[model samples]
Target chain A: MKTIKKVALTALAAAGFGAVPGLFGLPGSLLAPGFAATPGSAMAQECGTITLGAALSLTGKYSTNGLHTKNGYEFAIRKIKEAGGVKVGGKCYNFKVIYYDDESTPARGAQLAERLINQDKVQYMLGPYSSGLTKAIAPVTEKYKIPMVEAEGASRSLFNKGYKYLFAVLSTSEQYLASAVTLAAEVAEKRQGKKPSDVRIALVVENDPFSLDIRAGVKEDAAKYGMKIVIDDRMPRDLSDVSATLTKVKALKPDVLIASGHSKGAATLTRQVGEMKIDVPMIAITHCESADIIGKFGKTAEGFLCSTQWAETLSYKDPLFGSAADFNREFKAAYDMYKNRSVPYQAAQAAAAIYVFKDAFERAGSLDKEKVRDALAATDLMTFYGPIKFSPAGNNIAKPMVLRQVQNGQYNVVAPSKFASHKLIWPRKVQ
Target chain B: MFGLCDFFAQTCGNLSILFAAPVFNVQLLIDGVLVGAVFALSAYGLALVWGVMNVKNLAQGDFVMVGGYLTWWLTQTFGVSPWVLLAGLVASFALLWGLGWLLYRLVIAKVIDRDLFTSLLATFGIAIVIAQVLNLIFGSDTQSVDPGYESLTLLGGAVTVAPQKLFAFLLAALLAAVVITFMKRSRMGQAIRATAQDPRAARVLGIDTDRVYAFTYSLNAAICGAAGALIVMIWVIQPFYGITYSIRAFVIVTAAGFGNLPGVIASGLGLGIFEQFGGFVLGAEFQQAIVVGVLVFVLLIRQIQQAMNRQVVQ
Candidate 1:
């Protein structure tokens, strides 16, 4: 009984010691009243630095892409500082990115976004990687009336919620597959003297919003082209096995196969398709541009078509990066120095997301959130990544989607003739 | 509620029509059985260890994942592909057996005689450690082995079967046969059974029960490793996928009951078939849902059966 009493007292003492920080930190700040900032006057002083905050998935399933997104944002900021800081209210303000690891969970992302705005007092926001995380953080930014310019997050449903402050630089998820359908239709017309309506397509998608949006887009475009959808199925969650889908694809033998999912889904389809030896006239997958797909699939990825937002070979130019080629060279050199590898297209798009903000801040010429948001909404400019123009729904619809085909284990832009680095190789060669 | 009712009605209607049209194709059934064979091999390991040592190893699936990574490392890094990956699979099994012995000595030994839940929680911790260590070593990526086996179509090209899955099925069956034969005819196997039945009596009979326990656990790990090698050859594997395999093993072993070798095989195959049909009829989103749903359904049925037989769960 004496020993139990002593143990209880020790436990109580430990609890009290742990609570001391919270108890003492609150009232100790009450003596400091000069730190309070007046409304609208916070931005009136001459600015030396503007902090853009984000909650990124630095560790988790999305960590690989999250790291790339981080590199993109950092590279963009560094390039801006090198060129000259943004001129706002007749004063130059350098950029500083303040990020918190969201760990790839939506709830955690939303919580961190709230912390960034409420506690860190950030006025502008960049989104986390993936459509799901962006959707999670969108409401937090909207509640605070802070404008978020995001490079990723392609789900069409994100813009349908009537949120006023969420702007995306990447094309909507629906547009991801719409261009593939168009290219297929053009190929059918040229090669077989066939109308677009005669093309039969087998579509497999992941159940996530981004993939679902791609499915909706493909279906809409197929309908517009009069193409027939042979089979439209969602790959199983956890993506354990796609054999059932592959078996069905073998039986149906559609003219074109469109499969979209995350990185693993891409690898699974590529392997099983090889195993089942299910060869269609053409194969287009949404995540073909990801390193996981290329790294895992390797030589087998030949002749596969991929939907992309930016290509290093495109003719787009920007004041900061000079030309698309120059941006690629510089970006690749910088990325290699930092991490000893080439930068992914996702990273390039992320940097472009930052460019949108720079353009907006310069046009607005003020640190006010409303002014900057209005300037962003009115944006119609070109960057090394691509054109920056937002629709009423806050999606970038002005820039056209590029279709890239893997030839000899290298990604080459093949569609939208103006951006074509190589001709489209129809009826992918299987050996 | 109305939407659910409507969905049920639609499903019933589709089922009736599908029944008439022969929606359950031969190809799908064959694929289910092949996949189920893999599940059975892994499940056997879990049952063996659980019955002999009373250790509910939650890291059972992680053993399979580690086994797969071992084979992948050999194939990818060393470029060794002799005898359709036979050499690599053997090496993986031997390495996993050593790992199992180490794990038992370090962690499993402490919880060997504990209550079921305590062992369950401890093994769960071990599972997390294994998964994270694997991810750190292999770098979170999906990997598979390519045997360049062209699929052959059968039954009028209605059913396409890959050579790799067939090889996996044969290997799994062979391993199960060897284990059954060994258990029925070996001295160590008899000692293990003796200890499982009555440890005190077995000790009195001069059997080293502790040795039997360690051997049983390591043998289970080796079996899981062999099954994982087959999986890598046929399907893709990632570090986080260990839990799903573990769950499948647990479900199969529990539903089959202790020491029911034939029942384990039957349940694993049934699960595979049920998942395929569920994925086909309901959609791919419900594949895993149907797997877990069947587990619950099986448990409820077993409970009712036990109650009728005048048995109460302790």
Candidate 2:
């Protein structure tokens, strides 16, 4: 009984010591004061900066483009700060971007988006790399009512849903290949003196939602022009080999070949085109904008036209970057010095997304969520990434898809006449 | 369809378009055989490691990736000619063999004496580390080496074959043959076999089982490295491609079973042919599905067979 009493007293003393930190809030409150405060109500007012949170795919299959998107965000932030940031309610508020690596998975992307909103206390949000990731993150941002301006994630299905807070700067996936068919028709008429109906197309798409959307656009546009589809093949899931499809393509000898796949698929087609010697008049493949295609194929990459969201040679001008040319020159100089890289269309779109947010924030004239959202909805400004205007469904309807061809080992904008930096090169004069 | 007819005409190259009908799918078959040859090389390496070490090296493809990157780096850094592929193969093999030794000493040695589950989990961890490390070293980009080989028409133009692929096939076959001879005749091979059959008995008979294990792993890595060098010469490779290689190797070995050399070779070729034909007929979207499907089917059949054999014993 005497020993039991002593043990009970020791236990009580330990419990009292443990409760002291909980009751008095010793170092916890002092160490992390921001942890107890709300995001919009306290943090935004205290910092004098508008923090935009992003869950980017920094270390997975999408990491290549993810890093590009991150660089775009970084560049845009630097530019915004240089221009005295966005004006909100007579206050000059600087912009800051906080990012978490989502590892290219949709579930993890959603989780990180939530953490960024609730824990990191970001008022605004940026969309992730691919459409799948955006779809995952959109609902979380919507639930929290934080406005998200995204540059990538071009899936049309993402806009079909009625989500007000989420907006994308890049054109929808359907627009990707819609212009490819149009270009093929134009080339057939100009070069071969053939009618639009005379254009024969062979489509090889990657079996993913994004590529499937590209296929749908091609089909729809082909029907509009009455162009014939010779052979339609979906590249395997691994994107390992396309010999079988190429073998079929070799026989058909279609007037034009429109292929949409991942970066690897583009490289495979480029290599196989030379190896199998499939001679099509015009070869337009998506993902040529990727550094991998030219980096892998080198001179062999020449002559193929690629569907792109943005091209540096485009004549789009803005207050921040001066012109597309100026932006490219500045970006290349800075990015190459830091990471030895060239900026792609994805990076351009990412920076353009930030510009949209800056434009909206200043127009809203207040940091209020609904007001900023209204301003984003009313966005009708033109920048380096063409005219920025969002449809009621929050899809960017103004930016026209551009087709760029690799000529003399450099990407030149070739299609949508207004954006054309050069004449279309048909049949890729193979040496 | 006219397109189907055109396929035969184009495959038969310059043959009269009217004579397009043939009972055999010569084009797909040829493609399959060429692909099978590459798979066979990696399959042999996987089989050797799994049979002797009882450790499924999930990082098999990463080894192949490292080998490819090594060759690419050499070519890019030194402007090595395409013809130096033979020398590249030797260099890759030696370097990867050293890597194998290090892997065995650092990680594989820990799991060698553990349960199969432990080895699997540990190797999987190794695979993730290797993949991430490679990604960090070489950014996520698909790279390839040009061998400057043209396609050669075979069997009266019925089959179009890349000379580079044919070269890789021949080299793979020669290496497999040499390894087979080594296993059959070498004293070390006998010791390895003894250790695999009865580790305790082999140790009692004055055999150092640990040394055999290290040599076996290094040999596997060497084979994988040579195969990787061949792959870069013929096919495109990325940092993340190691998982696909691992999957292919696992499927081939499971289908062939442990310690069955001829079975491993035959099954690897069979899988390659099957995948090519399946991709063509069922559509390329189902190519990966076909590999996993075959693996699942084989496992089901084996399980049923095992249950039936157990009933007989009872």
lDDT string for model 2 (A278-393, tens) is 67878888887563566666666788888888877788999998898788888887686334445688888899999999899889987877898999999998998788899999
* Candidate 1 backbone collisions, by pair: A197-A226
Candidate 2 C-alpha lDDT tens digits along B132-151: 88788887877888765667
Quote each prediction's TM-score.
Answer: 0.85, 0.88
Put down candidate 1 lDDT per residue, A281-334, tens digits, no spaces. Answer: 799987775535555556568888888888888999989987888877888887
The candidates' DockQ values read 0.35, 0.35
Best by DockQ: 1
Q: After superposing candidate 1, which stretches have Cα over 4 Å from the reference?
A: A1-47, A291-295, A337-342, B1-26, B53-55, B112-117, B152-160, B198-211, B277-282, B289-308, B311-314
Write model 1 residue lDDT over B73-164, tens digit each, in one string.
77887664646378777987898899888888888888988888889999999898888788777766577777666678776655678888
